[model samples]
Target: MTATLPRVDTAPAAAVKRRRRSLGWVAVVPLLAFTAVAFGLPAWAVLDGAFTDKGTGAYTTANLTASLQGAYLTALVGSVKLSAVSAALATLLGLPLAQAVVTSRHRALREAVLTASGVLANFGGVPLAFAFVATLGNAGVLTRHLDLTDKGWDLYSFWGLVVVYLYFLIPLMVLTITPALEGLRVQWREAAQNNGATTAQYWLHVALPVLLPTLLGGFVLLFGSAFAAYATAAAIVGSSVPLITLQIADALSGNVLVGQENVALALSLDMVLVAGLVMAVYLPLQRRSARWLA
Candidate 1:
C-alpha cells in the first residue's frame, strides 16, 4: 500500500483541463454578453413597457384599449388590405417570371434576370419610393411628358403605397416560388400535355395542387414585409396618410400626445397582434407543404 501507483500525481492534468474550460468561457462570454446587451435587453424593455403604467402609479389595459380604437383599427385594416392585394398581384406576375428564369435556355439571360430580381428585391424603402415618384408623382417628368399636366396623381395615397409594395414583393415572390417550381417534376406537365390536356387543365389539376403550399408561404412572406414597411411609406407620404408605422414612430419619438406612454403601449400591442395573424397563416402553410410532399 505504501508503494501503490508510485505516488502518481493528477494535479497537473487537472490544471490543464481547467485552463481549457477557462479559454472556452473567454470565447463564449463575448457572444453571450452581446446577445444580452443588444437583442434581449431591448426586446424585454419594449415588451415590459407595453404593460407598464403611463402616468398613473397603476398598470392597466388603457393602452391596449386605446390601440383597438377606430383609427388604429382602420389603419390596421388598410395595411392588411394593401399587403394582401399587392402580394397577390405580385405572385401572379412573378410565377411566369420565375418559370422563365428557371427554364430559360439562355444562360446569360437567366443570370441577368436573377441578378435583376436580387437587386430590385433589396432596393425597397427610399430608393424605390423615390423612383416611383419620379415616374408617377404629380410633378414628375414622366407625368408631364404624358401630357397629364395639372392632372397630377398623389403617390402618397393608400393605393400608391400598394404599388410601391408590389415593386419589391414581386421580386421576392419570384425568388421564392421559382425554387418550388423547379422542384416540380417536369414530366408531370409533359405527361398531361401528351394526354391532350389544355394548359388551364394541367395547371389546375397537376401544378396548382403541388404548388399551393409554396405559393401561400410566399404570400405570407410578402404580407409580412408589406405590413412591417415603414421607410417607403414614411418617405413618400409622411403623416399625410395615416399608417401604422408612422403612428408608432410618432409615439416612440414622444412627438405627439406628449408624455402619453399609453399610446405607445397600445401601438406596440397592435403590432404584436398583426404579427400573430401573419404567423397564423404560416402554420397552415407549413402543414400544407408537408402534405404536398407526402
Candidate 2:
C-alpha cells in the first residue's frame, strides 16, 4: 500500500468467462439441433396428431376419447400388468444374480457374466421371440420332448410371455444393478457386524436402504422396456395378447380400423405420458441413489 498498486482489472477476466460460456453453448449446438430434429419433431407430430382429426385437419379430442375406451383400454391395462409383473420378477431374480457376479472370486467368471448380460439385454425383439419359440413353442423341441401342453403350459399364453420376457429382462437387470452392487462397501458390513448386527440384519437395514433407490430405478426401466415392446410379442403371441404397443401398431397399420391414424397418435401420446410419469418418479430416486453410490 506504500505505493499506488497497479490498478487491478476484473473486466478481462469477466470477458474471458463470458467467451468460454458462449463457446460451450456453441459446442453443444449440434447435439441440440440433432435432438430437435430427431426427437422433438416426431414427438410434436404425435402430440399434434393426437389432438387433431385425421380426416379433417381440425383439432379435436375424439381420438383420446376413443383410445381410452373399449379394446384400447384393455390393451393399456394389459400393457401395465405385463410391465409390472416382468419388472418385478426381473428385479427379484436379477438382484441376487448381480450380487453373485459382483462378489464372485473369479474375474473370468465375472467378465463372462457381464458380457453375456450385455448380449442378452440387447438380444430381444424378433430374434429373441424366435429363440423362445424354438425352445418352448407348441411344436418346439422342448415342447415335443417334455409334452408341456399336457401340463397346461402354453407358450402363447400370458404366463409364457412373462417367462420369455424374463430371458432378456433378467440380463438387463443384472447389467443395471451390478454397478450398484459393486458400490456396496465391505467396511459398512464390517461396521454393522462390529455393532452386533447379524448378516441378515445388516443387509435388511443398511444394505437395503442404500440399494432401494437403485432397485426401484431398475424396476422402472424394466417396466418401460416391457411396455414399449412390440416385435417380440407380435412374433410370439400376435394380437392374442392385449398390449398397448401391439394395439398401437394395429392402429397405425390400419389393421384395426381405417381413419384411426389419429387414434394411433393418441395411443402414442398416452404411452409418452405413461413413460413420462415413470421417469418423473425414477429421476428423484436415481438422484437419491447417486448421493450414496457416488
Per-model clash counts, in order, read 0, 0
Model 2 scores worst on lDDT over the 10 consecutive residues at 1-10
Off by over 4 Å in 1: 1-37, 148-152, 290-294
Question: Where does the lowest 10-residue lDDT sum fall in candidate 1?
Answer: 147-156
My TM-score estimates for the predictions, one after another, are 0.82, 0.97
Model 1 TM-score? 0.82
Tens-digit lDDT string for candidate 2 (177-245) = 998999999999999999999989998999999999999999999999999888999999998889999
State the RMSD for candidate 1.
Answer: 5.9
